[model samples]
Target: MTSEVRAAVFRPDDERIADAVDLLESLGATPVPDPMLAVEPTGATPAPADWTVLTSKTGVELAAEAGWTPTDTRLACIGPATADAARAEGWAVDVVPEEYSSAGLVDALTAAVATDESVGVARSDHGSAVLLDGLREAGIETTETVLYRLVRPVDAGESTARAAAGELEAALFTSSLTVEHFLDAAAERGVRAAAVEGLADAVVGCIGEPTAATARDHGITVDVVPDEATFEALATAVVERAAPSHHGE
Candidate 1:
């Protein structure tokens, strides 16, 4: 007989949140769906290049919606999820690094791409400089096109409040931005210290090493960083760790 586990998820206010809620519930955790990130499309597509790199599923979907195509250019994705999104849109993914991070993209492209070839990186406005810098250092020409902007939703403080009140058993951070946005919300609510202190006792899960690093930088102890950098992995690991008695599901 396991007690209810109150877990917080900070995805966008879109199908992402719905899917995250479903996953948490299936794992027997009461999900606190606080949308921390909202996507605003830039209405600009990636420029034509020898190789085009996409870093997120949302970017892939947005590009598809804009009737964008590879047009003889090779497609590269930062992770399996982004690759899957592109594949679903009938785009052939040429490269997906085994590491699944900016550094990973840099290594993969550096090894495969020629210095003469140009790469276009399409992602959110908050995209990391690691990828672009890595490519540039390798002498490969790379350009970035902001596909969208990720903004903190106004109603994103519920999870921070829950954490401050010690009502949350776990928190799943999907990205570094989510961690920053969560802290921002906490600060805005005047409960940043309390929330960080409360989270010290609860399970904090980050989707990847970068997200975990961000959580730790904010004085939040991270307990889990799943091998796969995906929302499902992060949520499932957090729920299982927070409620060990209910693992069979």
Candidate 2:
């Protein structure tokens, strides 16, 4: 049997979905695109700050949408891809920690900032508060701005849900919102049980511990979690899991 990967990409952009698809193909697995959420910028005004932290590429896109410029402030990114996105927007990246997480960014910022430097965080409305809390505890002035919001897709086709049920051998979740959106889409298609159980059997992969925890909360066991929470790392984990020895050759 050909190794087929059922991927649940919550990213709204086709390019993002294509990245997942390419990963699956490279592993000799057929990819099935089943996006569960759509990302939209909140149109919030950017305030002046000494430093700006970007947690996601979507957040970077939102900052661009709001006409924010890096020339006016320092930029810190949670991961290299986010940093690259910021750089693409002509922003200078001041810091990108070795570990790719908001907490990691906070730790890096804590070490770099003076006692009086005010930092602004651009992130989703719903996300972990670990970064904000850590920054505040470290005496760094932190202001969180909601940049983008994830909305569950209203038009999930039944065929996609059925694919999630019967054909997808593995599902990759990148965030908590992806998990929630997958559950919501599955429930809407009346395949909640199938979706959950199928994911449990399949090689469910997560980008980080937080996303893995979210999968666990939904009774979906994460079979693979990469060391770094980057797209490249996540793709590597998926490929490794699908390898013959890893899957019991």
Candidate 3:
């Protein structure tokens, strides 16, 4: 049997979807384009702070819509991709932690802020406020503004749902939203619990702990979690997990 890897990507753009495909192909897996969610930017608002934290490229795009420039404040990004987006928008990134999670970013920022420095965070309206909460506890005045919202795709196909129902070699999840949206889309397409059970036979590869936690909460067994939550790391984990086990030999 051919080891085909069908991924349910939530990104709508063809370029991003292609990137996911490319990443999967590099690991000797086939990429299936089934975006479960779409990202919509809400109107931007006035930013009020000396420093700004950006967790996603959508947040940066929203900042641009709000007439907010990265050069206007000290910019801190959660990871390299977000930092690249900030730099593309002419913002100078001052800090990007080794770990790519919100908690890691907060930990890095907690050490950066001394006293009386105000910071702003650009995030999704419904996402976690761990960074903002942590900054406040560290004595730094922090404000959070919603930049974008995630909505379920209008037409998640039945083929994708059926594929998810079968025994998957593995599934790679990038965010908590992906896990939630996948389940929602699956249900909308009438995929049942047996399909989710079939997925359990394969390794559940997550980009970070938070996403892994989300998977676990849904009763999905997470078999692999990358040490670093980056796209490259995710691809590497997929390849590594597919390798033959040495223990049984």
Residues 87-169 of candidate 1 have per-residue lDDT tens digits of 99999999999998999999999988986899999999999888899999899998999999999988789989899988988
Worst 10 residues of 2 by lDDT: 156-165
Candidate ordering by lDDT (highest first) = 1, 2, 3
> What TM-score would each prediction reach against the true structure?
0.95, 0.91, 0.89
Please report, in order, the local distance difference test score of every candidate based on alpha carbons: 0.91, 0.76, 0.73
Segments of candidate 1 deviating more than 4 angstroms: 244-249
RMSD of 1: 2.3
The prediction achieving the highest TM-score against the true structure is 1
| Model 2 / residue 182 / CA error / Å | 0.4
CA shift at 158, candidate 3, in angstroms?
4.5
